[model samples]
Target chain A: MDNIAGHKSSLTWAVHISVALLVLLWLLPTLGLLVSSFRTADQIAGSGWWAAPFPQEESLQLRTAGPDEMTQDGDLYVIEGNLLEQNGAGDLDISAWGTSARDVSAYAPGKTAEMRGGETMTLEEDGTYRLTSAEAFEGRGERVFVSATVPPEFTLDNYERILFSDDSREGMAKAFFNTLTVTIPATIIPILIAAFAAYALAWMDFPGRALLVAAVVALLVVPLQLALIPLLRLHLSIGIGKGYMGVWLAHTAFGMPLAVYLLRNYMVGLPKDIIENAKVDGATDFQIFTRIVLPLSFPALASFAIFQFLWTWNDLLVALVFLIDASGQTTVMTRQIVELLGTRGGNWEILATAAFVSISVPLVVFFAMQRYLVRGLLAGSVK
Target chain B: MNPALQGVIIVVLAVAVCVGYFWSSNQILDRVIFPAKGEKAGQNINRANMVRPWLFLFPALLVLGVYLAYPVVETLRLSLTQRVGSGYEFVGFDNYVQMWNEPKFREALLNNMLWLVVVPAASTAFGLLAAQLTDRIGWGAVAKSLIFMPMAISFVGAAVIWKLVYDARPLGQDQIGILNAIYLGLGGDAPQTWLTIPFWNNFFLMAVLVWIQTGFAMVILSAALRGIPEETVEAAIVDGAGPLRVFFQIKVPQIMGTILVVWTTITVIVLKIFDIVYAMTNGQFETQVLANYMYDKLFRANDWGVGSAGAMVIMLLVTPILVWNVYNARKEMR
Candidate 1:
C-alpha cells in the first residue's frame, strides 16, 4: 500500500513536469509576439525582444553656447545656468563639454576653461554657458556628452494604428469585423443546422435517418479546397459569390459535418430516460428536440459554437478565396494581418497589435465558453 | 385507390402546407425570431414544431444545396468534361487519366500522403502526452486551456503566427523569426526558406497543422482519459504495474477507440487542408498538396480537366477513411 501511494505521487510529479513543459511550449511564441508588439520599431530593429528591459550605455552628442555669450565680469568669465530642464524634460546634469568631436564631453558643464591667450569659457547645467574669451564666439558648435537616462516607454500607438488608422492596407480592424461577420453566422448557422440535424439524427426515427448522418460524416472528408473553385463557380452562377454571404456559406458547409457529428455525439450521450420521457409525453420529434434536447445540450451547442466561431473568426483562406476584393470592404483580420506582414512586416507593434486584436475575440470566447468545451467533449466521450 | 391521383394529392398537400407555413411565418418572423416590442416568448413557452423545423431548415438546405452539394456534383461532372470558360464538352475519364500521369499531381499526392501520416500521429502523440501529464497536475484545467487555446485560432491565424516564428532575414538585419535567429546566433550564414524546401517541407508545414490540431486532440483525449475508470487504475495498482506500464497496458487500451476516432478525425482534416499551405506559402517550395493543386489548376492555370481530375483523386483517396468513420460511428451508436 505504501509502495502504491509512492508510485502515485511519482506519477503525479511526472505528469506535472510534462504538462508544465507543454504549456510553456505553447505559450512562448504568443508571449514573444505580444511583447514584441509593444516595443518600438527602432528597439525591435536594434535588438531581440528578449534583450528588452535591460539597461545599456549609449553615446549622444550635446551642444553648449559659443564664446559669443561670454561677458567680461569682475575677474572671471562665469557661465551661470542649468544644463537641463528642471521641470519637464528633467535635470540631466552635463558630464563634460569640448570643442572638437574627439574631445567632446572632456570637461564638466560648470568648468571654466583657461585658454592659452587668457581666453575662458564656462558651461552651466541649464544648457547655458559663458565663454569669456577676449575674442568673440567664432568657433564651430560646442560638442558635449551628457549621460541621459533613457526610460523604457511603452505605447498604445501600435494598437491605435491597427484598430483605427487606414494607412495599413491590411489593418486588423477591418479584418476583425470581417472575421466577426463571417464567424458569427458561420458559428451560429452550423450549430443551428447541426442542432436540428443532431436532434433528428439522435432522436428522430425516420426512414433513411442513418443515411443522412452517414452523408454528413462522408462530408467530413470532402476538403473545402477540392470544392473551392466548383463552389465559387456555383456561387457565381447563383450570384452569391465573393462576399460575406459566400464565405459564410463556405464556412457553414465546411463546418457542418463536424458540428453535426459532435452535437449528435453529445446529444446521443444524453441520458436516454429524459428523451424517452419526452417521447412518452406525446411531444413530437421537433418539440422534444427544441424543449428537451437543445437546453440540455447547451454544453455541446456552446462548445461547438466556440469552435466554429474561432475557426471562422481566424479564417483567412476562405476570406481570401471568397470574400476579399479590391474595394477592401470584405477584408478580414487574418488577411489584413497578412497584408501587414507583407507590407509593414518590420513593424512589430503593428503586427503584434494586429495579431492580438485578431485573437482577442477568440480568447474571450475560449475563456468564457471553455468549461462548456470540456463538459461537452466529455459529455460526448464518457458514455 | 388511383395511385397517380394519390401522388398528385400528396404533392399538392406538401406545397399547400409549405405555402401556408411561409405566409403565416412571415408575420411571426419578427415576433419570434426578431422579437419586436419585448414580446419574445421565454424558454418554457416558446415552442418549435414540425412546421417550424422545416422553416428553419429550408434556407440552410437551399444554401447548402446551391453552394455545397451542387458544386460537389458539378465537380464530379466537371471531372469528365473539358471546360472552355463556362461551357464544357464531356471528355470522359481522360481527365482522370491525365491527373494520374501528371508529375505535379503525383508530387502533391505524395505530399498529402506525408501530411496524412506524420501530422495526425505527431498531434495525437503530443496531445496524448499533454493530456496524460495534465490529468495528474493540480493546475490541469489551466494547462489544458492554454494548450487548447491554439485550436481557437484559425488555420490562417496559426500560419500567421508561425510566419513570424519562421520569418527569414538576410544577414546583417535583426532576425525576427526565432528559428532563423537561432541559426544565425549560432553563427550560421544565410536564412533558408523553411516552407519552400521540397518533400521535407511537407512535414514542416504539417507541424503547423499538428500545432493547431494538438489542442483538439488534447481536448478530446483529455476527456477520454478522464472517462477512464479510476477503479481500473487503482485495480491495476494492486497488480503492481508501474506508472508507464499501467499507462500503456491499461489506460491506452481503454481509450484506444477514442484515440482512433481522434486520429482519424484529424486525418480527414489533414486531407482537406489547403489553408495553411495556401496562406503561408501558396503551395510553392514543393509544399503543394492535392487541394491547393486543384485550386491552381482550376483557378490559376484554368485547366478544368486537370483540376477536376485532381478533385476526383482527392475524393477517391478520402472515401475509404470516410467509410471507416461512418462504420465506427454506427458501431458506437449501437
Candidate 2:
C-alpha cells in the first residue's frame, strides 16, 4: 500500500512520528500513576514522576549542633556534627552550602563561611560540619542551607500497605476477593444460560425465535441504570438485599443480552450440514446441541466470557446498588477505589496503588485473551 | 457464612442445577412424554421438539425479562408515582415536573447532550485516524495496542489517572500534574485546576472517555478498513486521487456503515456514563451527567420519584438506538 501511486516517502515518516506522539500521549497518564505507585510520599510530593529515574537537585534546610552540645576548648566554643545525619538526608551528596535563604548555594561544600560574633562554620563534602566561635554558644542550633543531589529512590511500601496491611479502611485485598466472587459466577452462569438459548435460537425449530433474537438485540442497549431501582426494590422485597447473590444475579441478567447475541450469531454461522447429519442419526436437539454446536462455538463462548469477566470486574454501578451492604464487607474493587478517591484524593501514593491493583487483573486477562476479546467486539458490534 | 465460601457453594450448585435440569428435561421429553418406541411416537416426537426450544430459552428469557425488560416499565411507573412511606402514591408526571424545575437535572441533561455529541465524534475521529495511520506502518500493531490499553482500565481508575494529569499546586510550588506543568511551561501565570473550572471541565471529563474509547473505535474501524476491497482503492488511485483523497472519498465512504455502528455503540456508552463524573467532580462545578444526577436523587437525596424520572430520561435517550438496532436485526434476519 505504501508503494502505491502518489504515496510519498516523507508522509511515511510523518505517519510514524504522529503515531509515536499519539501513543506517548495515550500512555503518559497511566504511566504517571504506575511510576507514582513505586515512589515514596515525600519523593512523589517533591518532584514529578517523569523525573523519577534521574537524580534530583533540591535545596534543603539543615541545622548544626545546638549550643548545649558546644564545648569551650582553648578559648573557642566548638560545635560538630554531620548535617546529613542530623537531617536524615539519606544518600544525598551536598554540592554547596550557605548561611542564608537569599543564597542557598553561596559557598561550596568544604568551604568555611565567616559568621557574626566571630563565628566560623566549615562544611565538608560528606556532610560533616564544624562550627567555632570565640565566645560560648548562647542560643539554639544554627540553621544551615544546603543544595544536594538526591539519588532516585523507589519502594514497594505503598503496595505492602494497601495490600498486606491490617488497616481495613484503605486495603484493597478484601475488595479484590469480592470482585472475584462476583465475576467468576456472573461470567460462568451467563455463558451456559445464554449458550442454551443461543443454541435454541440458532438450531431448534421454534416460533418467535427471530422475535426473541431481536428482543435480545434491543435489550443490548437498555441502560443497566434503569435496572437499579426496580431490581433493588425486588431484591429487598425478596430475601436477597444487597449482597453477592444479588450482584451475581444482576450481572448475569445484564450480561445475558450480549452473551445471547454473540453466541447466537456465532452458532448460526455453524455448518447446517452438521446439525442435519446429527439429526439423521436420530440424535435429539439436546444431543446435537451439547455434542456439536457447543464444542464448535468455543471461540464465541470464550469471547463472551472475557467480555463478561472484564465488565463485571470493572463495574462499579451494578456492585454499588446490588451487592454492597451498609456493612461494606461486600465492596468490590471499583467501589473501593472510588471510596479511596474521595477520602484520599490528595494522597497520590495510595490512590495510584489502589487504582493499579484494581486495573491489573483485567489488563492481564485482556492482553492474554485479546484475540477472543477483539472477536467478541467485532461480532457484538458491526452487525 | 463467609461470602467467599457461599460464592463457591452457589457456583457449584448453580452449574449442577443447570446441567441437571437440561439432562433430566431431555430425558423426560424423549423417554416418557414422547417415547419413540410407542405406537403414537411420531406425534409425540413432534410435540416434544416444539417444547424443547422454549425449555432451552426459558432461563435466559426469564432473566432478561425480570432484570432488563421489567426494569424499563417499572422505572417508568416509579417515575410517575411518589413514594409514600413504605408504599407508592400515583402522582403522574409530577416527578418529571420536579426534575424539569431542578437546576441540577437541567445541568445534567445539557452536559449529557454535550457528552453525547462530543465523546462519540471525537472518539470516532481519533479512532479513524489511528486505524488509517496504523494500517500503513510496520509497527502499527504495537501503537494500536498501546492506545487500546486504556479500554481495560476501569472508569474509576481512569478518573484517578486523569486527576493526576489535571492536578494543580499553588503558584509558587512545583506542578506535579502534567496539564498544569505544560500550562506553566507554555508561559501561563498559574497552574489551573482543570476539573473545577466551569463548562470546560465537562470537556476534561469527556477527554477521559474519549481516551478510553478511541482504542475501541480504532480496533473496529481497522478491521472494517482491512475488509474494504483492494480494487476500489486501486481504482481511486488510478483516477489521479492522492492518498488523502483515496482515504476520505474511497475508504471512509466504504466503511460508513461500520463508522455509524461504532458511533452509536459509543453514544450508548456515553449516555450511561456515571463513574468518570461521579469520581472526578461528583457533579461539582456543573459537570453532572444523567447517571450521576439520577444517583444523587436516588441515594444522596433519597428522592425515588425524581431518580426514576432521571432513569427514564436515560432510557428515552437510548430508545432510538434500541429501535434502530432492532430494526436492523429484523431486516438482516429477513
Candidate 3:
C-alpha cells in the first residue's frame, strides 16, 4: 500500500510538470509581445523582449556649464555638472560617466574629474555642477554623460502613434470604429433573427422543423469561401455593392447558421414545462418567448453574442471580399493589423499595443461573462 | 363568432401582423425568413395553430433564411455558372472539371486532408493526455483553463501574435521569431519562414488551431474521464489490473462516444479552416486549403464557376463526415 501511494505520487508529479510546461509554452510568446510593446524599436530589434530590462542601456549626449563661473585659485580651473535631470527620458544603468562621446561613461555618476592644466569638474545627484579653471575658459563645449538604472515601464506611445498619429500606415482608430460598425449590427441582426427562429423551432411545433434543423446543421459545413463570390456578385447586382452595409449583411448571413443552431440548442434545453405552462395560461407563443424565453435565454444569448462578436470582429475574409475598398475609410481593425504587420512588422511595440487594443474588449467580455459561456456550452449536459 | 373562434382569429391576425412586419423590416430578412414561417391566415379555420408557430418563428427564421439559407442556395446555383470578364454564363460541370484539374485546387484538397487528419487527432490526443495526466493531479481545472485561454483569442488576433513570434529577418541577423531564435541559439544559420514551408507548413499552421482547440478537448475529455464510474475502476482493480491497464481497458471504452463526438465537432471546424491559414500565410507556399482556395478563385480570381465547383466538392467531401457525425449523435442520444 505504501508502494502504491508512492507510485501514485510520482505519477502526479509527472502530470504537474507537463501541465506547467504547456502553460508556459502557450503563454511565453504572448508575454514576449506584451513586454515588447513597451520597449523601444532598437531594443526590440536587438533582443527578445524578455531581455528588455537588463540589457537595455542607453547613452545620451548632455552638456554642462564651462569655466566662466570658475573662481581662479592659484592655477586651478574646474567645471562640473550632472547632465541628467531627475526627469531625463533616456533609460540606462549607470556604471560610469564620461566627458567625451568616445569615452562616454568613463567615470561613475558621482565621480569628480580632474583635467590637465588646472581644471576640475564635479557632478551632483541633483544634476548641478561646479567648474573651476585657472585659465580663462574658451569656446570649447563641456560634455557630461551619466548612466542610470532603467526600470521597465510601459508607455502609451505606441497607442498614441497607432491611434492618432498620421504617420501610421494602418491607422487603427478608424478601423476600430469600422469594425464596431460592422460587428455590432452583424451580431445583433443574426441573434434577433435566430432567437425568433429558435423559439419557433424549439417550442412552436411546426412541420419540417427537423428538416430545418438538419439543413442548418448541414449548412454549418458549407464553407463561407464557397459563397463569397456569388454573394458579392449578388450584393453588387442588388446595388448594395462593397461597403459597410455589404460587409454587415455578409457577416449577418455567415453568422446566422451558427446563431440559429446555438440559440435553438439553448432554447430546446430550456424547461419545456415553463413554455408549456405559458401556453396553457394563454400567454401566447410570442409573449412566452419575449417574456420568459428571452430572459431565461440571457446566458445563451450572451454566450452566442460573445461568439458572434468575436467572429465578426476578427473577420477579414468577408471584409476582404465586400469591404476592401482602396479608400482607407472602410478598413477594419483586423485588416489594419494585417497591413501593419506587412509594413511595420518589425515594430513589436506597435504590433503588441495594437493587438492588445483590438483584443481588450473581447477579453473583458469573456472574463465578465465566462460563466454564461461555460453553462451555454454544456447546456444539455445533465439531460 | 364563438369564443374559441374569436381567440383563433385574433391569434391568426397577430401572426399575420408579425409576418408582415418581418417582410417590411429588411429585404435580406424578408426573402430568407417570410417564406419559412409565412402562410396567409385562413379565413375559415381556427387561427391558434396557424398563427402560433408563425408568430414564434417569423423573426428568427426570416433572418436565417435571408442571410444563411438564401445565400447557400444562391451559392449552389452560382456554382454552375461561368463568369467571363464581367458576366456569368451557365456552364454546368465544366467548372467541376476545371476544379478537378486545377493544381492549386489539388493542393488545397491535400492540405485540407492533412488538416482534417492532423488537427483533430493531435488536439484530442493531447487533450486526452493532458486531461488524464491532470486528473491524477489536483490542479487540472486551472491547467485546462490556462490552455483553453487561447481559444478565446480571435483567429486574426492569434495570427498577429504568432506572426511576431515567427518574424524572420536576413541571415546573421538577430532572430525575433521564437522558433528562429531557438534555431539560431543552437548554432544554426539565420531565419526560416515557418509559415512558408510547404507540406511541413501545414503542420505548423495546424499547430495554431490545435493550440486553440486542445483546451476544448481537454475540458470534454476531462468530464468524460470523470464520468467513468468509480465502481468500474474498482472492479478492474479487484481483477488485479494496473492503473494504466484499467484506464485503457475500462475507462476508454465507456467514453468512446464522447471522444468521437468531440473529434467530429472539431473535424467540422477543421473542414472550414480558412481563417488560420489565411491569416498566417495567406495560403501561400503550399499552405492553401480548400476554403482558402475557394476564396482565392471566387473572390480574388473571380472564377465563380470553378470556385462554386470547389465549394460543391467541399460539401461532397464533408457529407460523409456529417452523416457519420449525425449517426454518432443519434447513438449518443439513445
**Fnat for every candidate:** 0.41, 0.82, 0.46
Model 2 scores a TM of 0.95
**How do the residues B248-322 of candidate 2 rate in per-residue lDDT, one tens digit apiece?**
999999999999999999999999999999889999999999999999999989998999999999999999999
User: DockQ for each of the predicted structures, in order?
Assistant: 0.24, 0.83, 0.29
> What tens-digit string does per-residue lDDT give for candidate 2 at A72-164?
779898998898998788767889989998988999988999988899999998899899999888767999999888888899999999999
- Return the candidate ranking by TM-score, descending: 2, 3, 1
Which stretches of model 3 miss by more than 4 angstroms? A1-6, A57-153, A166-168, A379-383, B1-47, B136-138, B169-174, B187-191, B326-334
Q: RMSDs, each prediction?
A: 9.6, 2.6, 8.1
Q: Model 3: per-residue lDDT, tens digit, B10-105?
A: 345545655555444333333343333346433312334555566556655655566556666777787788868777788887888878888888
Better of 1 and 2 by DockQ: 2
For candidate 2 chain B, the 10 contiguous residues with the lowest summed lDDT are: B32-41
Per DockQ, the best of the predicted structures is 2
TM-score of 3: 0.80
- Fnat measured on candidate 1: 0.41
Assess every candidate by TM-score: 0.78, 0.95, 0.80
Best lDDT among the predictions, by candidate number: 2
lDDT of 3: 0.71
State which candidate has the highest TM-score.
2
Clash counts per candidate, in order, are 9, 0, 27
